[model samples]
Target: MMFGVNSKILDEIVCILSKDTNVESAYIFGSRARGDFKEYSDIDIAVFIEDPNKRNMIAVDINEINCIYKFDIVIIKESTSRELLDNIKKDGVKIYQRPF
Candidate 1:
């Protein structure tokens, strides 16, 4: 898949993911999130959910206003551990945390 993203697109993705009932939080990771993207880098997203087993999630590509970006959703059990949160903190730059 062609990999690239911008703040406007990211905002749209966050909005979409937030609408999902299973999702509690959404985040962006990896190169695109770090502002050091190349021509080929899949946009990585971390999705926090009420239950991973509740449903299967997939990446959604939303195009509007001619903006392009890859949006991915990951589902984790709602009760996430501190370690995971810490890891997100350690790699915080890659995370585009949703604004509640």
Candidate 2:
């Protein structure tokens, strides 16, 4: 149960996403969240955004980050609806959460 990337990556992601108005909560999930990730396994990230229209910007940000870093992407919108957020939190590991 060891994580691949160091804590620096988490800090970097938090810092990067925090600066953007589109990003709400950025959660790290999959093997990394469970602490069973290997060097080959890409880090799974679940990003919750405030505006649904900003998804394109979120994707661009993630893609830009991935281009510089190595990881997989999964973006979810929190402000869009409660249903999806509940489902994601219930299903995916709650790596990060922003209080409304």
Candidate 3:
């Protein structure tokens, strides 16, 4: 039910993303999270991880999982600007968090 995205598909996405050990958390933001998406709107996701080097690879892996929807992956690192992190925290909807 996330911005017209199928719940089953979202579940599958979560399952796939969870396989990445470096992913500390994931959030949905932008139009999809706000519920104002158009038919062509891309899915926006932000992933928080400790290792910045793994960002690109993680994005590639997620993109390879499915092609039914367009995805924009934003990788958040420990060194990310506080302002940007705060903005994301305020506007994003947390979709997944790895178990401690």
Candidate order by TM-score, decreasing, is 3, 2, 1
Across 1-100, the per-residue lDDT of candidate 1 in tens digits comes to 2125556665666666666676666656556656678765556666766567775443543323244444434444557677766655555443334455
User: Which lDDT values do the candidates have, in the order given?
Assistant: 0.55, 0.61, 0.80
Candidate 1 vs candidate 2: which has greater TM-score?
2
**Model 1 segments more than 4 A misplaced:** 1-4, 58-73, 77-87, 93-100
Q: What TM-score would each prediction reach against the true structure?
A: 0.57, 0.65, 0.82
**lDDT digits (tens) for residues 8-98 of candidate 3:** 8678668867888888889988888878898878888888886777534767877876647888888887777888777677778889999
Give the clashing residue pairs of candidate 2, or none: none
Model 3 CA deviation exceeding 4 Å by range:
54-56, 78-83
lDDT of 2 at 43: 71
lDDT (C-alpha) at residue 66 in model 3: 62
Candidate ranking under lDDT, highest first, comes to: 3, 2, 1
Comparing candidate 1 with candidate 3, which one achieves the higher lDDT? 3
